[model samples]
Target: MAHTITGRKRLLARVRRIQGQASALEKALTDGTECAALLQQIAAIRGATNGLMAEVLDGHLREHVGAEGLSAGERERELDQIAAVLRSYLK
Candidate 1:
């Protein structure tokens, strides 16, 4: 969102790090890394991804759903959108 533009750099940095982590995981699989190390890598990736999702979702809740100037209709729309996204993401 435009409100998140201020934090875009930080978000992008997190995404880049996650990309690098995924690449490392790929390389590790190619090299047949140990199971423990592989599990650690996978966990790290999942945690980082969840962190990114939480950050964006928090921003959306604040700027789009919970903002003082937003009408009930607008808030409902934003809530529905986020709920749909949460359902999909959970699956």
Candidate 2:
């Protein structure tokens, strides 16, 4: 429930789509689908996963770090920290 308030529906929709892509990938593997087709599925899943991550991260920033009274420098530092963590996580 990363998005408890606004955009929850949109986030859930993305998650549902990602789940569908994952299920499709599993089915393709079980069916011994062609290599190229499997690769395409994998790519789509990866893109969807990345999109979901970006959405969650955006929500986190807006909710946790984007407080009403934070100074500009503090916000920038927080954003930098978040970006660093994301880079490490992706790596």
Q: What is the lDDT of residue 75 in candidate 2?
A: 86
How would you encode candidate 2's per-residue C-alpha lDDT over 34-90 as one tens digit per residue?
Answer: 999999999998999889888888778887678689889988888898989888978
TM-score of candidate 1 on Cα atoms, chains taken together: 0.94
Predicted structure with the largest lDDT when compared to the true one: 1
Query: Which ranges of candidate 2 are over 4 A from the true structure?
Result: 1-4, 71-85
| Model 2 residue 69 distance off true place after TM-score fit, in angstroms | 2.3
lDDT of 1: 0.94
Q: Which residue pairs in model 2 clash with each other? A: none
Instruction: Please give the range of 10 consecutive residues that has the lowest summed lDDT in model 2.
Output: 1-10
TM-score of each: 0.94, 0.75
